[model samples]
Target: MSRSILDEAHIHPAVRSIVANNHANVIAEVKAAIASNPIVVVGMAQNPFPRKARRVLDDIKATYVYLEYGSYLSGWRPRTALKMWTGWPTFPMIFVNGILIGGANDLQRLIASGELSGLVAA
Candidate 1:
């Protein structure tokens, strides 16, 4: 289930370099957090969904690392880099056991179905 991306050769070399290095540091930070934590919630400021996701995790007594980017007004570029990296278009990108399990509502479904406990337990 991999997504399609433009081939490197299709992009000009100069453009390729820029794309490669675009917000690399932020991506690195996120990569480090994901590597260190089994449950990582990548979110943004002023986004209600991320907070809702956090609350859900709290109710389940799940331990997770949360990383928030810029709010609606600012920091969209840095967050865009994240969107390019993960291919998830929405905020509150929640990952469990190093795998993306979608956002808050998805999280709720997993919990309601008794799958979230198994995921965290694993």
Candidate 2:
């Protein structure tokens, strides 16, 4: 199936501009928030964890940031910031409205039983 939530010729102009102009910043902000929140999940991309986590985020129309350690620590030493925020050392962190949802196993359990959708939708 299609990953897109949009229909052809029905693009919202404001959303298009926001996506184009501020995508990077938006992603960064979400990443930082995930690092800080207790209701978000963080994991590795190569791990199966992120696949389902990503699907849930997409299903709920949630915006997320997928970060590698190097990129996450690129300019301002995100490791320090992340440590201060989450106290956890990991990647592929998922956040919703700036809340942490735990890691891969946690996400899997939530997704398998459909609890993830309820939380995300809320």
Candidate 3:
């Protein structure tokens, strides 16, 4: 089988087991969403970045799916493993066309440069 960046060698064993049971469908679900929608955002509610990112997307009328997990999940630990899995160290990990598009700041930069609109429209 092909290996992804989230390969077992890179992730902690506990994180892997947590993902296997609790978040096994995350990557697949995000992939399917991004396939049909152009943008997919995974983040936590307590983090201001994700909310801000949502507002920005709303302002631009961008089609996207925001998956907020941190606070909503009991004890809010899976997001940590997810963070390790994605290798992104913050909330609001945005994806455009199935590609990691960084966080709110990156999105703002793209919006400022007019690339965000082009990406969402495409």
Q: Write the per-residue lDDT of candidate 2 for residues 14-122, one digit (tens) a residue.
A: 5766434433553466566565543455444355556667776677565665554344325335444554355544554556556565665666677778877677666
TM-score, prediction 2: 0.45
Q: What is the lDDT of candidate 2?
A: 0.55
What tens digits encode model 1's per-residue C-alpha lDDT throughout 1-122? 87999889999987988999999999999898888887899999999999999998998788999998889999899999989999999998988887789999999999999998788778
Candidate 3 local lDDT, residue 112:
97
Model 3 TM-score? 0.72
Question: lDDT of each structure?
Answer: 0.90, 0.55, 0.77
Best by TM-score: 1
Q: Which residue pairs show collisions in model 1?
A: none
Top-down lDDT ranking? 1, 3, 2
- Where is model 1 poorest over a 10-residue stretch in terms of lDDT? 113-122
Q: Could you tell which candidate, 1 or 2, scores higher by TM-score?
A: 1
Candidate 3: C-alpha RMSD to true structure equals 4.5
